[model samples]
Target chain A: MNLEIILHAGLATGTVLLFASIGELLAERSGILNLGVEGMMLIGAMTGFSMALATGNPWLGLLLAMLAAGVLSLAHGVVTISFQADQVVSGLALTFLGTGLALVLGNGLTGQNAPLIPNYDIAGLAAIPFIGPVFFEDHSPLVYLGYIFTPLVWFYIEKTRPGMHLRAVGEKPVAADTMGVSVYRLRYFYVFVGGCLAGLAGATISLSVSPGWYSAQTTSGQGWIAIGLVIFAQWNPLRAALGAYLFGALRRAILDLQGPRMILGFVNPLYINPNLGFFLQMAPYLLTILALVIGSRAAMRKRIGAPAALGEPYIRGERGL
Target chain B: MAFPISIAIEKRTADVPRWMPAATSIGSVVAAFIVSGIVLWLIGSDPVRVYGFFVRATFGSWAAISDTMVKATPLILVGLACTVAFKMKLWNIGAEGQFYMGAFFASLVVLVPLVPAGTPAIVVIPFMAAMGMLGGAIWGFFPGFLKARFQVNEIITTLMLNYVAILWNNFWIFDRWSDAGFQMTPTFERNAWLPRLSDLAREYPIFSGITLHLGVVFGLLAAVVVWWVLERSRWGYEIRLIGDNPHAARYAGINIARNIILVMMFSGALAGLAGMSEVSGVVHRLQERISPGYGFTGIIVAWLAKLNPFGVVLVSILFGALIVAGREVQPSGIAQMIQGFVLFAVISSDVLLRYKVRLVRTRADQNAAGEAA
Candidate 1:
């Protein structure tokens, strides 16, 4: 019923997706398409919550979460990179491994309280109108981190010298190799970076955003949604942020739709018939498909596409992208 | 002083030995078990005792074997479903959704009384099977169409549709078809049930209490058919060609887009059959929690079987045992963890197929050669 509150919650929840998609964007930019985001996120959430609870330090928990997920990603790196396995299958295997590991380790941590990341409002910025409250008011430190993280990622991928090298590695590894860039090293590094960010996103959900562990439900399918957002954003961090926030708002609005019976003088079907909320629950997924269609069309029209060597294994003597 | 030892991995110029693939696969499974045991030990459980319990619980008696078989029935179909799509290099991760839709469609035969109430089992069973396949095929067609037309990624699309399909099923079971306010439809009449060995208890008292259903026969038939389709049929050749080399396949005048849609539908149909089998043979009702991740398990089964149809049946039985026994294991995720390790080991073991690994002495002469290389 309240637009402001919903948007505020949207921003907080959107931070989770923002971190995940941006992380995925980094890996894909380096010619590695890791579909293990969901698994990695789950691992992160569980690790963050449990670590915080055991240690009583949210910061240490956050760091350990990233480390755990990053270590897990190395498995993918070894398989797809060193052994030259299929990226899609390896990523899927990574998901299974991550989920299983998290589930095993996170057992009995449910309903236990943990030291969560504290929230604070920016003194002057919080006083501004709608933007002030939604963007700068009482929110987890991670939300502010996301705001700063997006543009920094954009800058690092676009304007920096290493960014050019990163793009070159993805688009034309052979060319990058000829220029003395270590394609394998960069891919591994980026994949690890992606893993760490996905872990951070998971921690955001368990330690900052929602502030508890719900096992698999903690990240739910947000990690997958983040992957979709990467496509919709065309691998751009800024656009990913936009899509993430919009999706967050949409998710929040859907939950709120069942709250009130009357909506602008019209009876809300979702409120009247609770079963109809199932359809409302489906909006985000349906929109992802719609987004994919739009994204695909745009890519075709603009002749913009995925990284040329996105899913290929880079062998030193192989004749390929 | 030079290093005493070094590892070398050289690409194999010659074809791998005939037994290498099989050896690697078996090795991977054993390795996975060892790794899972380590994890179990790390978690403070006795790995040997736990594994012992698994074997005993799954194969302890005829009844346990029958239960495992029931679980394997759906797995065989779903594994075949994954095999067909993965062979074409199309990732149809939505087998879970397709399975649900299949169950929904199968249930429609009895719930809507599509035939009259007293229809014979002969007519009604086949109708239900056909409807189940139809529902699954329909569920699969959208992602296939999207991928073929727009070059959209099938993995994400298929996965997204899974959530939609489950929710769609929920709407019906929760509100429209609730069996006296329970989250399931009313049980189907006996005519809709698949014939089981237990049904012949009057003729053979030894078969009493057996829950093994005709669905197992369906699974066996599906495996043979899938094997034939992949190995003997001309379309199978086309599919393999596309899978191995898409550009070569296109140049050979193969219609890639049409095959994509067809193969996806075929794959979906198999998974749909799995959903139907579970509903008609076991649950006997359309319910929300019918599957305990059979579709997801099927992916691992297919991979473990190396995409062979007969191999799928064997793997499904093993995994079926895992599922059956896993219910009793503590911490609840040991089986899933073992599956993950198996998959990881399997893929990693492919290194043996492509490269020859050796430990070379690196005192003086070898060290010089290594640097020169």
Candidate 2:
């Protein structure tokens, strides 16, 4: 119920969405709108948990998780990029594939213990005021990594030669192709990168934030939330980080709201009738919808939109977006 | 030395053969089975034995076949739901949510006792069905309205609403309607239940033990109706046009926004009907997890059926078999895995429809041919 604790937990949980949305951002930036983040994340969570259990090394588990999800993303790349299938349908199929694979592989791993990512406090930063305790205090190393990762992604996408090429491929594949950028190769590579990040996000949940596999419930539509965050962030890494943390805090707040029987001198309906917590549980999702509405309106008013060629297949010599 | 051969893919300029699409779909299903078998073998399960058991358990007996049909009934409705929305290029991933809402609404007939006690089946069933559709339609309307008005992505909106809908159902089931604090409501009286073949066991002794319900008839009727709507109706043509080319549809003066809302409602209604059918025809009570991902499975069914209404029915039957057999499968995810493979194969197979692949010899072989000429 404490503000500091909720914010701290939010940072830890937000790291999961941070990695996933950034991954989705990378893929969309390359004009491949992959809706399979949920599937990839689930696969990552399952693989990370099982590998951590089998090898007794959380680091190896993390790497394998990324690789497995990366390989799975390549499936989407082949279908959408090479075969030129409909990206939406292919993405949906990828989710089914990823979820199925994770479920099958993770069948008996439930309730089994695994090595987890360790939490650490920043020495000087932890000693600071409220910001220090909430932001820099004891947290999964992934949370600290997320703090550094967001700015790095922003730099990579907004301030580099490769980033320009990435933008070009997404915005105008024909122009980028004429400039000697291999549109197909770049799309495939970014899609893979996106997959890896989604996997990392999934691993963040299993080995770090929440810890343990709960089958489909392990990722629990957070991957989908990440995709929504991408849209809400309007494809900006820094904005995505902001949205992710805010959503994380909001999710934590929803859970915490059920704890207090009295709020601001009044009784809490949810606390009294625990079943009403179901409605409370829906806050994150409802908020996501609210965020999308706001995001879409902002985009409309500001003329900031999705990548120009997002969701279009880049076939050579084709007349298309 | 360099490789002597290279693979080349060239886009097709002409339409494919009439039978090609169907052939590719069938071929994809076969390929999916082979791939799934490989996966099973990799996991140390004998694919043959598992698949053998699948056939035996799903179609081994009249009873097994009837059970599969029972499963297929809901799928058919949900598949049709997907077909209508997908035809218009609206990815209504929230059919799962819409289905839940539908169940909740339909259950009100018995729980709230909307009708007086002992209402005849003739009056109760249709009213329940209509209420179910109304619930689903309302659930769908929000996303549709948002997408049409604000240009909000319906995919995300619909998906988000799914969680909300499920939780909404949970609140009722776990609180107000819990049968002695159980997670489900008490069983409805016989009048509220859909008439099953077993209901006539006395008059027709041969039909004894059969659980096939009238919901299958609903599924069949829905398919025919959906087929007509998509094929014969002007609105259907408009939906296809909007899906294929929105710009052209707009140029042709089609009201895209209105259609988006309407089609979504229609789609949600079908899915709602599916939920209603499940509660009324099978479970005979309102409960949670009544669907083992039938709403999700319907998406695959629609795609595999190529959005053809009658094709949905056939695909649902196959998936029905998979679900019925999946219960006994050890890994428990084998059916889902197979479905994933099927979708992958089907989409990959679409390449054959759009392009021609050929093996070409390298420069040396070309030079040899030139010399011979």
Mark the 10 consecutive residues where model 1 chain A has the least summed lDDT.
Answer: A312-321
* Each prediction's RMSD to truth: 1.9, 2.8
**Considering only N, C-alpha and C atoms within 3 Å, which residue pairs clash in candidate 1?**
none
- Candidate 1: tens digits of C-alpha lDDT, residues A1-321: 799989999999999999999999999999999999999999999999999999999999999999999999989998988788999888889888998889899999889999999999989999999989988999999999989999999999999999999999999998998999988889899999999999999999999989887877888889889999999899889999999999998999999999998999999887778999999999999999999999999999999978888998888766865
Give the distance in Å from residue B362's predicted Cα in candidate 1 to where it truly belongs.
Answer: 4.2
DockQ of structure 2: 0.56
Q: Write the per-residue lDDT of candidate 2 for residues B1-373, one digit (tens) a residue.
A: 3877766676688999999888988999899999989988998889899999999999999999999999999999999999999999999998899999999999999999899998999999998899889888988899999999999999999999999999999999999999999999999988888999998999999899999999999999999999999999999999999999999999999999999999999999999988999999999999999889898899999999989999999999999999999898877777888898899999998988988766776565343112111
Docking quality category of candidate 2 according to DockQ thresholds: medium
| DockQ per candidate, 2 decimals | 0.59, 0.56
Top-lDDT candidate index: 2
* Residue B268 lDDT in candidate 2: 94
Kindly list the per-residue Cα lDDT of model 2 for residues A1-321, writing each as its tens digit: 799999998998899999999999999999999999999999999999999999999999999999999999999999998888999989999999999989988989989999998999999999999999999988988899999999998999899999999999999998998999988889999999999999999999999999999999998899999999999999999999999999899889888988988988999888889898898889899999999999999999999989999988876765756
Candidate 1 error regions (>4 Å):
B362-373
